[model samples]
Target: MELTFASYNIHKAVGLDGRRDPDRIMSVLREVDADIIALQEADRRFGARASVLPRALLDDTRWRPLPVAKRPRSLGWHGNALLVRRDIKCLHAEPLDLPTLEPRGAVLAELDLRGEHIRVLGAHLDLSGLRRRDQIKAILKQCTRRGKMPTVIMGDFNQWGRLTGAMQVFGMGWQQITPGASYPSARPIARFDRIIATPDWSYETSGVHHSATSAAASDHLPVWASLRTA
Candidate 1:
């Protein structure tokens, strides 16, 4: 089976116009139209850490978020959230704490799609290079602890170029799918957003989801990949 997965940093649902419009973010998501989506900065930075994209609004969408929130108001842990198609069955979901100077975490989920079990990890790593490598090791450890399956780890990696420090840690065991420059949605010069998968899956196509609405929705444009079992 072939499935499309996307990773987006919604910038807390704030656009380049300096407007906080959750609807616009939804519009971009619709345009991407991926089967699964990994979101960074989906929740507010402070206070209750409530989600910028309200749960009520997402109710109208085709995607359902994994129940991995730590707080009643938060959508996911540490601004990282995972969303899968409404038909997908969530087998297991957990929040992971990353080693960082600031509040940084990752979300993990096991889903059953037509009796096919798979894993998804959503993360937004730190700005510091050192912290990012540490975060990757932590995430890698989690992946190793889980049973082998078709897995995808995606989010705003915050890495500037293609072959960078943190990505190197993932090494040859995993395949990195960079859909090109996805940051600064207006111009998209840096590839901050990315998707990584194990050898169990092979990619069909991948690219940045750029459009009029997407460019206005957030600082980082969404990156997507089409993949099937190897």
Candidate 2:
């Protein structure tokens, strides 16, 4: 089986022009066109955490969002959302807790694709390196508790330099697909987004989704990967 996965931080639907347009964000997502997409900053930072993207817009697509919203107006937990293709069956969905100075978390979704079980996690890490490490540790611990499967952990990692030793938490088996510079979409010089899969899977192709629309949609461009499972 081959799966196309993507991770994007929409910056709460605020474009480079300082406009909050959900329709424009939808257009960017349409361009991504992945089987599964992990989104960060899907909700507003204050108030009820209202979703930046309208429900009607999402319903128009072939994608179905995981229900991890705590408030009626919110779309996700800590502004993180997981969206899977409508054809994919969701077996389970939950939010993962992380240690952070600000409101930060991840969403875990166990999906069934033609009877194959796969775990997908989406997260947005803290800007501080130290907090990011602690959050990653917590995520790794959750993976340990879930046992094993074809798992993928992806989202805005906020790590600019090399992955280094911290990524070893996924064990030597996991493969990291380091997509090219995705930050500051206009003139990307940092790879702040990432996608990693367990040893059981291999990425046939991966890269940053850069386009004029994408660059205007948010500060961080989306990263994507094509995974092959035999």
For residue 31, give model 2's deviation from the true position in Å: 1.0
Kindly give the stretch of ten consecutive residues in candidate 2 with the minimal lDDT sum: 162-171
Candidate 1 TM-score, C-alpha based:
0.98
Q: Give the poorly placed runs of model 1, Cα more than 4 Å off.
A: none
| Tens-digit lDDT track of model 2 for 202-226 | 7799989888899998998999999
lDDT agreement with native, every candidate:
0.93, 0.89
Model 1 lDDT tens row, 1-230: 89999999999999999999999999999999999999999999999999999989889999989999999999999999998999999999999999999999999999998899999999999999999999999998998898788899999988886777878998888989999998788887898889999999988999998899999899999999999988
Model 2's alpha-carbon lDDT is 0.89
Lowest lDDT sum, 10 consecutive residues, model 1, at 158-167
lDDT score for residue 193 of model 2: 92
